[model samples]
Target: MSTSGSKDMSRRHVLGALAALPTLPILPVLFGASVARADDAPPPLPSWNDGPTKQAILDFIHATTDPSSKDFVPAEERIATFDQDGTLWVEQPIYTQIIYCLARVPVLAKANPHLAKVEPFRTVLTGDFEKIAKLSLRDFETIAVATLTGMDVEAFAAEVKAWIAEARDHRWKKLYTELTYQPMQEVLAFFRANGFKTFIVTGGGQDFVRVYSQRVYGIPPEQVVGSALGTKFGYDKAGRPFLTKEPKLLLNDDNAGKPEGIHLEIGRRPHAAFGNSTGDRQMLEYAKAGDGARLSMIVLHDDASREYAYGPARGLPDTRVGRFPQELDDEAKKGGWFIISMKDDWKRIFAFE
Candidate 1:
């Protein structure tokens, strides 16, 4: 995926709501269309609690979309990029992609028997999650690179699709897809309803996410930009064309690389950006640098009861996965980025909740 922030909507953005009179009647229109009663209308963001965070989101959308506003942006220019892991969904304990990579180790080892004797692969084969979590970054890179490469693009995607459908997060015994945050899902739909185009800019495997983005998040495959594997083109014996996944890394869609990927893939700067970690800091900065009204928001994982919370930010807890450093938190405060508190802002964590 081409990896690609504003926190606050001030008075200019906080638009007046259209309130209905008590005497007004809901009427059916000419072509059998009916006026939606204010009470019957679904809330813009139902999962979000009534607070400044929710209001800020609505205000930004209205300010940019309203023709009367100075910040009014043409619909085509309304682009919002989101980071996938901690921002859009859970990334605590272990990342979904890392789990997928590690799961494939036994199969890979079976094919190349010698791999079973290796350090990381052997640890991975142990099937003990605690030990696996302790594996070094270098070890994960080795496992991920091995698992992700050595297949045709179509075959690779197909494998991921099948796996995603069956993979369940051990904690909740729910499918990974079911673990998605309800508030974020509402934000996505709300943005689309307001004529904004949304893109998933993840640091996870590009092809892995593309397999399920549309089905799970309503984001199409082409709109995804992420860390990718290199590919080579060739023909089979029957002259059928195919692209083979290579071991070499192409784009690293994280940190400073995020803006670079966005520029390369999207061409235009996004009006807004959302993320949840230090990796997302540069992307948020990039969005804020854009002209006109912009938003830079961070989803601070501070609700351990509802969801896993680990941010060395505000001294919640420290974690190797999805780390939210105090330094990033300080920068967000100074930069005017909204730090979304899941505990206070969300009425529910998952849709299942």
Candidate 2:
């Protein structure tokens, strides 16, 4: 048979076969295009394997941000505070700031042999980790002040800039400037996207952190608040206005002092707060107690594979040493806080080379 006659025979056979079977209701066919559209839809953010903790955070944020919601917070009150050291960057092994101070000891010792003989500086010069770790907070502060003294504010800023440019984190094999958490960077962006103004509240020297914070963390100099040495407003030999460093007014932005620093610098309570250690417990509490919807988050340094792990170290016997890990656990059990496990929550640590 010709091709058309053969096709006609095949159709007749198919019709005869269907006719032999029992009659059934017709069903609608779904097109590939429509099926694809349904399958390609993005999953809801808080539902995508984030667990209960992350879901609660997303729900809280959504509740506060939705204008029609009863829990909506005004944009003007959306201040977010962040603790710097272990919160945004690495503080394990040794703090980056302490490394900077220790680096200055050799130079300072050359000019003043008395520093070479001092407990902390002596420990630092001879690379005695045990002794360095044992120095009292008062002794450490004395060394910090001595190293920071004499230079004018502008000169001190320049020195910090230069030091940052050259200093590398011993564990990361990258400059201290490059040790910022990639995940936290995304969180900062997320806050900005959510109409929150951010500030870095830290225990490190404010002037030191402010030197590069804006470029590194997107926070402006005026928004960076931390421990500060006393400054003297003065004029140079040519009568130009200048600010000089003095050996007084040490505002240590650690432990209980964090709340005081926040009150002094931002002048308003924050609606959201992020931090990484027990040093930040009070700041988180202060943020959580604000009049409106608030979020308090702690970045737990649990990712040993990606970053170094540390608990609070026992400091030297004499000074007011800040509390560490056990306190962190207490804060966690206190509840109403978001605990972010770095290993579980972050896909990456620092920015890639």
Candidate 3:
């Protein structure tokens, strides 16, 4: 039989088996929402379809984690790095961090007063969202520094916490943290359940993500690594010590910087890596370079009905934020990394769905 015909036959066999199984009571396995189970524990990646993408993860996990498997890796050596933004949750239209920055600009302008007259700041202050949305990444970075820094670390954290608590995604009317992808959350939990140490390596600010990483993703602040600005050691007026957020670039934890950040912060190469954009290409490459049973996956944003779709990868809409360019898609295919189609592989995207 030809290869394509054989694969079709195999798929039919799998589907036939699935259709034969009785629908039984399932032990609850939801991301943040759960009900009591009656008998059997539910399968991992319930939000994921029973396809090659899900099968690859299952195969990798069993091979590396089973004691009798030849590919079994030592517990301490099982490190998985994940890129944030589109990989975990939503990064369409604009990044959630950038949204936070946009919200902060007016508040900061109110406090500082003089900043209201600045170009991007002036544009932001006008409340014309069309113009604000068109602001460049560099412009947003400047606005982020202006709003998120200058204050002491604690104050910066407190403000972020406050905003995160109250801020909702404009489209969904849910908290931004609540917008995390349910399938990805299951992946994180499954990796941890199998002795893998999961770390978030993002292009976002380190200190900013740290404030809510624990509550949002269940990853501790220490395990989060991201692009970082500098801080100054000093004392407050009460003779207490504090670290002020300074205007200095420390690490740019995206693309090529991701591998460097992993080396510096993790002290070892990851066994598995997951990402969603061109910015994460190098991290995926670094993970694939590791010896023995490595896996790299990219979450392709190709579903528009359930969520926003913008991937120049498979002729989807081109987007500035979290771009999945055609070349990057080609590299993933050539490099033997899995491209997870959001439209097909994911049964559901967000938990709310």
Candidate 4:
């Protein structure tokens, strides 16, 4: 069969399997409205209004956490995983890692000189986005290797930290860290408060995500599982050992790799999982496939005005960076996975004004 034919068949198989899973019924609990303190202050998931989507989470937690409930899960067993790129932060226009690579080119070219005339670097330097956007996956991986490798882990992490600190989103003009969804922040905290351990499973480099995962999302470095390049253990003249980043890929925590990452790193099935794009389908499936009560949700980027909208849905552009295929939505609907529509569900998108 042709490559495209094989992919279409694979997608159909996945969608069929997902459609077979039973959708959990929405529980009749007004948990969101009832969580106000004596001072009439907002609840933990304040950004989530009293709606079916928010109530579903409340019900899931209540059922799984209450000792008398049949669905009661032990605290240690309550694991929750999230996708970082489009799910936790803005990933439109280009991936933040790609942006970082583009920014590093000039400095790298200044040192290497020859890299200034290279295909990817030369195009990136000229700011020809159309050319950059047309680059194949192999081309992106080439850029990743050039900019991300050769340094010790600590040095690479420091560079990533510095870049993250200064990098601003082109649309909002705020720092990228400032562009996290307010509702998702609440969701992270809410899950933690409910005895669920939250983790970020992303397609971005583990080393890069580790630099700011704790500060940005309140998730520790140990809780992050992501794509990685190979590393080499070496010692200096003083005999201090360090791990140097190698250009070759060790793992890619995306698509089917997500569930593999969760299993390999966390060593347990998640009680809940959240993501926004088709890359997250396998992770969501892994979460929902757990023995007991599970909550798997997808964040629908429907609010084009507040944030960029691109999906294989009505009137939405077909985006390559963070594409949300229509089949994923169909599977979500079929499988009873909650779809968190940014337009309908989130009261706020960014923490910034």
Candidate 5:
């Protein structure tokens, strides 16, 4: 993959809906030839191949969008939120951002020599991830703070962008962004095409995910909401005002925080929500709680061949990063939400290979 392409998916692993209106009459004509050939045209979710999972998505969109249906929602109220990490891309072995942090410790430690002797930093400096992984959450927090803070927002973003351009996944040997799931990309485009506003709600840092969200996921910066650290606004020597990242937690944006971020950032409850792990449980529940036609779905990583498989459902690796516990599975089933099986539903994984 090209450098930009790969950089687009690099992450530090942290890690809607409906309407109908008078515009409906001209909706078909809006696409010109694509509309003219509607009957003979292929499915909008082309990446889905043909399956029950795909059909469920189609049915939900149809029911919520049809003007005649009581379930029809207005275009303006069609807000859809998606969890990043395991939902949009991958969060296996560990979060990509953690890999970035590990790589950064050595650089940062050069200036702050004490970090080299720190527990997790000491382990990270030795390049022993197995040991690093065994460290407590507090240790990981220390590492994240050390490498990710102390820089101005613009500089930090540029640094992350630069790292993404150069970083390659250890296992795939491909650019991290190159690993974005193809079917989900199609789903994103599909929602946007149908007049829904899509927002990315993730636990990853706001500054981190915003760097490439537009380029990689077609979601703009304003539409991207995520966990953020406190930032201090000040002027540099040149009197240029800037926001410097602080080693303080601003918002978590995971579990219960997901709904809080959506309400605070997006201001509207999502009409549809998609996620892949336990961190997403509250967001799914929030979407389903909205009073109109709604959709809630979770992507199950069940395809070990094309991708990693671990879940709250499938007997797979138990992970601290993206845990899919049993309760999440039971909730999804009880709520009548769709559980997308990556192994069975998707014909392809990545857009490349």
Candidate 6:
């Protein structure tokens, strides 16, 4: 069979399996059901549980979209940003990337005896997280650069792709791809339906996000803005362009850097933002501070059954996790932001099989 024919057949098989499953209520249709007047349109997210918070979201979307409404916001200004780790993806037990790095330490140890003697990498190889946490920021950076060095950009991307294909969550025994939040997927679609351009502003590697985000998050490579390592463009003897790794210019996209990265890459301020943890505070602040209609949301990892819950901020080896109980309360009182409880808000956590 031709490649296209094989692809078509594969899609048909997947769709056929999906069709055999029980039908779930369509979100847009459910939203339309809430309107009493024949000519009136209901809110974009009617399937969401009804409450003051849900109503506030609906009212904000409507007030901002309707030209006749006092709070009308222009279509050009409808940019939304989202943080990836812990917000859209699972990051418990440990950050997913850190887990990936830990898995790789033994492999590196075989080639470089120096890694076996190092503080964090040594602790990582031994699964001694308590000792790993004692390493300084510089020590962490050394391990990261050493582990990530020497590979061309394309080779590195392929390695990540392969790793993801084989890697399962330690506790769940499911592919890392399977751990994404189902409700957030709907939220992404909902924003797209409302004429909002979505961008990912994450602390994860920019190139790493670009490789799989289109398939995973429906956010394209051009729409992803994140931390970056400098690369030099060069050509070999055959004159094929290649990206060479650099020893320097690594930009970390956490905390205050979030706002700077957004300003530099996205240019315009986002009107809507979603994140989890204190790393996102600056980005949320920047989005909320924008003039006109704006909304910011934080995803609280309170659901332990569906996902791993590991907050109240435990200090991780080489990284400081944000604990924001007081800040979350303050943001709630301010009314500009929404705190989504993963336990209560989501009816389902992962996508239907």
Ordering by lDDT: 3, 1, 4, 5, 2, 6
Write down the TM-score for model 1.
0.90
Single out the weakest 10-residue window by summed lDDT for candidate 1.
1-10
Model 2, residue pairs in steric clash: 134-316
Kindly report which residue stretches of model 6 are placed more than 4 angstroms away from their true locations once superposed: 1-47, 109-120, 127-136, 310-322
Identify the runs in model 5 with alpha carbons over 4 angstroms from their true place: 1-42
Model 4 residue runs over 4 Å out of place are 1-41
lDDT of 4 by residue, 203-315 (tens): 99889989999999999999999998889999988999999999887788999999998888999888899999989999998889888789999998888999978887655
lDDT of 4: 0.83
- Model 6 Cα shift for residue 59 (angstroms): 2.9
True-structure Cα RMSD, model 2: 13.2
Best of the two (1, 5) by lDDT: 1
Give the better candidate number (2 or 5) by lDDT: 5
Candidate 5 lDDT (Cα, whole model)?
A: 0.81
Error of 4 at 198 (Å): 0.5
TM-score of every candidate:
0.90, 0.78, 0.88, 0.87, 0.87, 0.78
What does the lDDT read for residue 328 in candidate 6?
A: 56
What C-alpha lDDT values do all the predictions have?
Answer: 0.84, 0.73, 0.85, 0.83, 0.81, 0.72
Task: Report the Cα lDDT for residue 300, model 3.
Answer: 93
Q: What tens digits encode model 5's per-residue C-alpha lDDT throughout 249-338?
A: 889999999999999899988889999998899999999987867889999888888888786465776766788877888888999788
Index of the highest-lDDT prediction: 3
> lDDT per residue, candidate 2, 1-353, as tens digits?
11112223444575567567676543113224433433343323311236654555556666666776687878777788899887888877777788888788898899888877767778788887778888888988877887777788999889889989888766667888788887677667656656778899998889889999988999899989899888888888999988888888668887788889988888888888888777788898888887656788887666567875445422312212223465565666575787777767766777872
Model 4: per-residue Cα lDDT at residue 162: 89
- In the range 287-332, model 3's lDDT, one tens digit per residue, is 9988888899999988899887888877899988899999999999
The 10-residue segment of model 3 with minimum total lDDT is 31-40
**Candidate 6's error at 50, in angstroms?**
2.3
